[model samples]
Every structure is written in structure tokens, then in C-alpha cells.
Target: MTQLAIDVPENIFSTLRLPPAEFAREMRIAAAVQWYAEQRVSQEKAAEIAGQSRIEFIDELRRRRIPAIQLDLDELEAELNDG
Candidate 1:
């Protein structure tokens, strides 16, 4: 596992009304959501990156009004056929 370090100015915390820890957590979730929304990563991987369970990540996606399903036409058809 690789660790990433971001240097944020202390004043930004005040502006966001969040503590450093909370802000870091929010950023992690945001990154996970963005990557997942873009289909750049799988939901499981995104959940791991966000430090959340699969269900929690899916809930978060719903909360953000982003579709949790990423299947395209071919994939959807295959899934429908298999079901």
C-alpha cells in the first residue's frame, strides 16, 4: 500500500469548517466518488480507497445522485440474458 501526503494550508480548514481529519476523510470519499463515477475504477476498489464498505459506497453514490450501475448496453444485455 502506498501512502499519499497532501499539504493543505491550515486556514483552509477554517474556511471549510472541518477539522484536518474530517477534511482528509472527505477528500478520500470525494476521490473515490469521482473515480467511480468516471468508471475509472471498480466499486470494490473505490470503496477500499474511500475506506468504506461496498454497501456504504453504493449508498454514497445514491446520496450524490450518481448512478451506481456502470454497465453499458452490451454488459446490461448480457446480464439480463443471464438472469
Candidate 2:
């Protein structure tokens, strides 16, 4: 795995009231969420990037109200009509 180092302003942690490690963890999850939302990565990849299991990642998506399935209106209609 590749490691990245970044410089963050000192006041950020105090302002957010989060420890450095916790802040970094949240940033990773946020990045994964954005990439997944934009269709830039698969669910598996996003989960890996978020440092979470597939099920956990899916649960997080649900909690955030993001759709797990990416379907268009026509596809949704067809699925609904299938009995």
C-alpha cells in the first residue's frame, strides 16, 4: 500500500475536535464516498479505500442516503414491471 503525507493546518484538529488519526480516517471515508458517488470506483475498491468491509461500506452508504444500485429510470421501470 502506498502512504501519503500531507500538511494540515494546526488549528484544524482543534476546530473539528477530532484526533489526528480519527481525522485521517474520516478523510479516507469521505474520499471513498466521493469517488464512489462519482462512479469513479467500484464498491469493492471503495470499501478497500475506506478501510472497511464490503458490508460495512454498504451500510455506511445507506446511512448517508446514497444509492447502492445505479439504475436509470427505464431500468427501474423495467425492474418494477417484472413480476
Question: For model 1, what is the error of residue 23's alpha carbon versus the real structure, in angstroms, after optimal superposition?
Answer: 0.4
Lowest summed-lDDT stretch of 10 residues in model 2?
Answer: 63-72
Candidate 2, residues 1-83: lDDT per residue as tens digits?
99999999999999999999999999999899889999899999999999999999999899888888777799999999995
lDDT at position 32, candidate 1: 99
lDDT of 1 by residue, 1-83 (tens): 88889898879999999998899999999999999999999999999999999999999999999899999999999999999
Top candidate on TM-score is 1
TM-score against native, each model: 0.88, 0.84
Q: Give the TM-score of candidate 2.
A: 0.84
Count backbone overlaps in model 1.
Answer: 0
Cα lDDT of candidate 1 equals 0.95
Residue 37's lDDT in candidate 1: 93
What's the lDDT for candidate 2?
0.93
